[model samples]
Target chain A: MAESHAHTLDEVRAAKSRALAVFEPLAAVVGVGITRIGDGYGLKVNLREPPPSDTRLPTEVDGVPVRLEVVGQPRKQ
Target chain B: MQLDSARGLKRALIETVLTPFVSVGPQVKILAVPAGPVAGVSPVQPSIAVGIGRKAGHEFQIAVRCQRRELMTGKEVEQIRRKAKNEVDVRYIGPVSKRAAPWTQLRHRPLQIGISTGHVKVTAGTLGAFVRKRGGTDPHILSNNHVLANENRAKTGDAIIQAGTYDGGADPADRIAALAGMARLRKTEPNAVDAAIGKLDDALEFDPRTIRGLGKLAGLGAAFVDEGTEVAKLGRTTGLTRGRVTAFELDNVVVTFDIGPLRFDGQIEIEGADDGPFSRGGDSGSLIVEANTRLAVALLFAGTEAGGENDQGLTYANPLRSVLDALKVDLVAE
Candidate 1:
């Protein structure tokens, strides 16, 4: 992961766009949310489960730090 | 990539990825997930969710929902991932539904589901759900204001009937409940719901657990719905029908009432299969629920009939959250 760095709202949004495009296809991934980490912004990728640290997912996309956040999908009753 | 500006792009991307699987054949029932955070997932990020199901006659059952077999091979799923610009956050779920059962004859006068019921003096409308006042055990009949309160023309203590007037309910023979409260609909004011409730004259005269075709009142859903949420409802005309939420945040809708045309705001819309409608004229007042969880989501009131066709046009509703707040009621759990 990159050390904490200063980021503008515009940069954070750009990161979201770039990250969304990069991760759109992986199955079981649910959503991409914006998050605030320390003084900079981070991207939170929601998934059905926690991905392995060595998975194809990147630690950063478009110069923004990314983190995996497990978000279980709603199931049929 | 402001969230607002990127919304359209994201929606298009998901649509492009799923378009092929949407209608591979008539056996499939698929809809686009709205661009928003998938509910129950943390951090409220933007993403799309797909709801898969099947429609059977008057009922849309979700028992066959999104099985792995229905979705096909892993290669196809991989193809969707690649086409989606590698934006891997797409979410999938099995959305299910239960049909509202038609009302049948019972020897007792206890109010039954799937039968005609409305304001005693007013014509008729479906008694969509049975509810209890917030913090109170007294049961009440929930329906559209137009049905129980005559579009704001009725008063508290007015008589309500099991078989609506159209079904010949009159005087004391069919008395079931009385108008207790109603959420007002305004012409110039922004309105989010069109709901009303009547207090049952006697608890023994009614059974709150059963719906006409739908088995039992499960419970209330805790949140708002995203596009593609599978839902079902029971009404007087249509009996029971199910479909998906096609759109939302509809402000500036002009609906016709007995008095005249009234404008409504912030409504949700549901659409059935291409072959038929999800609701009909007397279906207003039906309650929409998540097919699988049996959780309540919307109140079905107004619908459009496209080009004079007998089938329901498009069904519209108020989010259940707003309805509960406006009416000060809670779902009566069995």
Candidate 2:
């Protein structure tokens, strides 16, 4: 686990925007959010399943880490 | 050994080994017979098994260990077997940890929070909390639209019942409230909350500030909570469970509703603490509160089947402020 350099909330928000723009359009991607990575801020890309190996997901968005998480499809509980 | 003698030995073991630990009080169950075969003991052997069961996440491990060390040793078992003058195998079963039983589905008097409740047309869901119009004194029951309004199908004055229809609640007889209002669910557009309210019946009484297991509500929390914040909820299906904010400001979450697939934006995600689930079916209307402060954080509405670190699944919620604003009510808190 790596911690990002101290970044402002505005900077993280900007990074989230950029990450969502890229990930949200993909069919496997379900959600994108600003989450705590290590002790700092990063973008979490929630996917319905693991993306295809050919699919190129961003490792970082504007220097903020873009961590991928595979959360199953959400249903009204 | 004769069956009668074995029974006597079982009672004696319980008195000597289990009774002294009763003061520990962690929802333990002591059984004389083992449900399964003990490791080194033969199935045909006449064994007086002493089993201790505890619910997961309970703080009684040290006490259980002490009991095991003090009274369940091989020498103790041999001594007991010799005194009984029989080939009795005394086995010590585990302090097995399991989930809490579902008690919220039972019909309650005085309307307890976190019990089963729903619209007459719906199956069941949890009573999230109590709320009132800003500056108004009349209390209202708060829950999800799907719980109290049948996901926009219910009318303004539709009957809301305790224990819900799935749990044997019938309209008119179990009616506790009338559907007052709801934040309608949109088919195509993105939604923020799935909340509704019911006007409390004049004859009914409820504790405004207390949630079933979580105690008193402090007040409203911030609309947006940061990740890693510890939270808890008591619901119809799962009772009280704790978790952590796994993600916040989550966007583009698609939820499957009875109407159709609906899109939601800017939601919060929670993962159960200790690999347990925070919510389940019939738990759709639980209120997520900050663990320490007890401030209302979010209104639970949806969840995933199998994902995240929790073996059960991840839970999603509407920010409490958003739900209150959408419903035009304030939480009735002390």
Candidate 3:
């Protein structure tokens, strides 16, 4: 879900220098980043292409799925 | 009650209110009495006096707040003046008092947020907002860099709008930064810090115009939702969506897709049907803003392969608390 800009003067006044404005509202859930550093040491967000209904995730831009090798004995998450 | 007896009433009032301060012992006492006037009654006015007993060096004091009332007819009116030294903070003891302020019920925990970067052309579904790095006591606007811009270099006053929701303020493409750009994050190659921080240029711009409006500076990150907490957000292609937080502190996420500087997060999920949560394509960079304070919590990142039938609302978010700390900003009002 998305956030809106509907705060009371008192709420906004205190948040005067903190909140960022969002104009667009997409129908689906995308990326949420915690910027620690890449450009700066802070959280950032990113939106990318969605997977096709038939395709699984962890693929390259060309739609090639990835492979992984477990370093240690796998453990439950 | 007698004049001395009235003093007893004042003592009762104070002790009744500060019952939950933990530091205060139960031995505390207060007394209150009536000491005012009634327009249609006798000359004897009615009012309340409060008092507390003190021993040697340790002491106690009482305070009373009054209101106009028509309780009894005044029978006698006389001047009564008494003076006593005070021992504690007493004045509008309603707001912060324990009897007055109670703890809220716990509802929902943190959810994972999936983010995409059009510029980098990579997305990380397992990405999460690391709050511990910034300490638990921070509050500044927070989000992934890709959420703020297609390019990593947004100006300090660049407009950052939540494109995932129906916003009625200045366009997100037209907001200014209070701190420009200064977020720190941990290095992905090793244990590091890499996060973004922006100063809010305008504090009272979005405040509602009403008697009960609270116009203050508020930042994003640490955005949360309760179980069954209905909320929404707007993304690149999806427009606006709705869901609730179902879990928190989900870890051991490994994004298998990579594109040089770009990352394609394939394992994340949001608003799923049965194949995991969340819809896909162009829904990145959206902030999961909560309803009450309208604060941003999850940076719309990725969706899962599961559907609602299999618990589709497993969305991820970069908590706002860590972002606030990196910016050296205050997360809560004192």
Query: Model 2 chain B, poorest ten-residue lDDT window?
Result: B30-39
Q: What share of the true interface contacts does candidate 3 keep?
A: 0.00
All models: lDDT?
0.61, 0.76, 0.30
Q: What TM-score would every model get versus the actual structure? A: 0.54, 0.73, 0.32
After superposing candidate 3 on the true structure, give the runs of residues whose Cα lies further than 4 Å from its correct spot.
A1-77, B1-142, B149-179, B182-229, B256-282, B290-297, B305-314, B330-334
lDDT by residue (tens digit), candidate 3, B45-130: 12322344443444444333222222112111011112233232222322222131101101111212221111112121111122
Candidate 2 Cα deviation (angstroms), residue B203: 2.0
Candidate 2 C-alpha lDDT tens digits along B1-334: 4445545665676677444444344433221111111123222212233433332444111112222533455554555555555344344554444344357877887887788898887778889999998778888999999889887888998999997776668979999999999999998888999999999999798876677677888889987699889999988877899999988988888887777788888899998897678887788888889999999999999988776675578899999999999988999875
Which digits, one per residue and each the tens of the lDDT, describe model 1 over residues A1-77? 55568765567667765665687565344445455555765665545455655667777887787766443431100
Chain A: TM-score in each model: 0.73, 0.80, 0.23
Q: Sorted on TM-score, highest at the top, how do the candidates line up? A: 2, 1, 3
Off-target runs (Cα >4 Å) in candidate 1 are A1-77, B1-108, B307-312
The model with the greater TM-score, 1 or 2, is 2
Q: How far is B272's C-alpha from truth in model 3 (Å)?
A: 5.0
State the displacement of the C-alpha of residue B75, model 2, in Å, after optimal TM-score superposition: 54
Query: Which 10 successive residues of model 1 chain B have the least lDDT summed?
Result: B29-38
